[model samples]
Target: MSNQQPGWFPDPSDAKKMRWWDGNEWAVHVSRDGAVWEEPLVAKTIGLKRRSRWVWVLLALGLLVAVALLSPLVALVALVVLVTGIVGISKGSGTWLRLKSRRTAIGVTAGAALVFLMAGSVSAAMVPGETGAPTAVETAQSAEARSEATPRRTSTPTPTPVTTSREEVVTEVIPFERSTVEDANIARGETTISVSGQDGERTITYVVTVVDGVETGRELKSDVETVAPVTEVTTVGTYDAPPEPAPPAEPTCDSNYADACVPIASDVDCAWGSGNGPAYFDGVAKVVGRDIYGLDRDGDGLACER
Candidate 1:
């Protein structure tokens, strides 16, 4: 094995696996059946190994270069490694330390320090210098220079002229006229419409003045009757009726006669007795006063007695 070149060789601890040997030492990289993985070489004794200070210095330089070219995640990994190394050194023994080696502790601490230093250097390099940033006065001067480079022209707006226009408009309206007629058949003070009146239409023209889409004024241009107005006819009643004849007066008995209602006529006689008469009296008649009808022939006041 000492004379063999750096290559995959059979693992000493496990014959079924193959391990990688660098020029100086065995690497943690291993492979089996074409598959590759990492596994630290087991130490024969659980004792710490001694390493020269130069090894630690070289590892620190390598980590610094890696951190400078890689991302911040690499820096964080280095910090964890450094913390683990410190804790292991304080406890004098730690399960995390491979082979419990003091050399690994020193290498991790130095590498973490170098990584931080390189990260700070990279940050400082990316920052802009004071002279590189523009000041307020310089910015103003540059803007003035740009303004002077181009000449600006001022534009004036033209005023709009006020215009007027006239438009003719035609409108239609309904109109009607009413007139009365005398009718003999209708009674006086009682009128009735003989004919139904209808509405008529008239057309009118107007001239309007408009300025800038707005109406200013309008004037009557012409008016013409399109349809003649219909006249409304009204009938009035006028009738005079003749006076009615008075009813006949009731006949009354003469005051000169008593105990009988004698007929008031030019001549009267007893109902069944004999005498020329225009009227007759039933039963006998007695006269208390003058006998106007001559119903009593005796001179006594009481005539036709018994």
Candidate 2:
């Protein structure tokens, strides 16, 4: 029988019921006339223990129901405790007779009871006065009805004004420019102003935004040149004068003789005739002015006659 595979088998104490064999021992589950239910094998012999288990189960169920009606949070906690207790007891001992398992069950039952009590207290605190007291909606409606029976005066609020204006023209100055031009008529290294510069004017249009009588912002709408600017013209001299002619060179010959050159020396004579001299003139010579050389013998205008 110890080596037999797990299966349903006839109960040793009852012929009408079949008990599940879990290979190691008889399981707590039994079927009678094809209807299955969990029943400890020792339940028949210990009726007192069975009754005590029913009492605990019934008490936990009652707590769960009561908490569920009062608060869902408490109800969820009670459900978890109940499931944990059932599992712990089931796994501890088949008959729930172990001291530790019984203590666990009792603790779970007590925790559920505490949660139910707390939920009840919270539910009672939420409602003011007694059970016959008016609800929150009823109280609010009564207050509203009482206020409607009377009226009070209220002041009207003043409004702020915002204004937008377009095409607001603003004038601005446009400075003149200066330019240079080369003139050949003027002397070199000299400069003179041809046209005096005059400043110009321009007008700018804008879209202005004002809030509460104060200017907030403005956007450029258009720009127009009211007066054209005059450009100052400067004349720079580029003319250079031609160089002067060089002075005439001095004459090399003497200016005393008119016809031929007569050598100016201590004594001058003709070259063809006999005249002992260091310097001599061979050509015929004539004296227009005083004869400086005294070469003429007959006092004629001729000297060194040949």
Top candidate on lDDT is 2
On residues 72-118, what C-alpha lDDT tens digit does candidate 1 reach at each position? 56656755565555555545555375634777676665656556556
Clashes of each: 5, 0
Cα lDDT tens digits, model 2, 1-306, are 689899999986676899999998888989987799998786467777778789978976776576656664774565445444444444453233234557767676457546645564566676556476444335334544554543544578988686866558899999999999999999899999999999999999999887877888899988899999999999999999999999997664335666787766776767876778787778877777777666676877787664
Which residue pairs clash within candidate 2?
A: none
What's the lDDT for residue 45 in model 2?
70
After superposition, the stretches of candidate 1 with alpha carbons farther than 4 Å from their true spots are: 1-155, 159-168, 253-306
Give per-residue lDDT, candidate 2, residue 289.
75
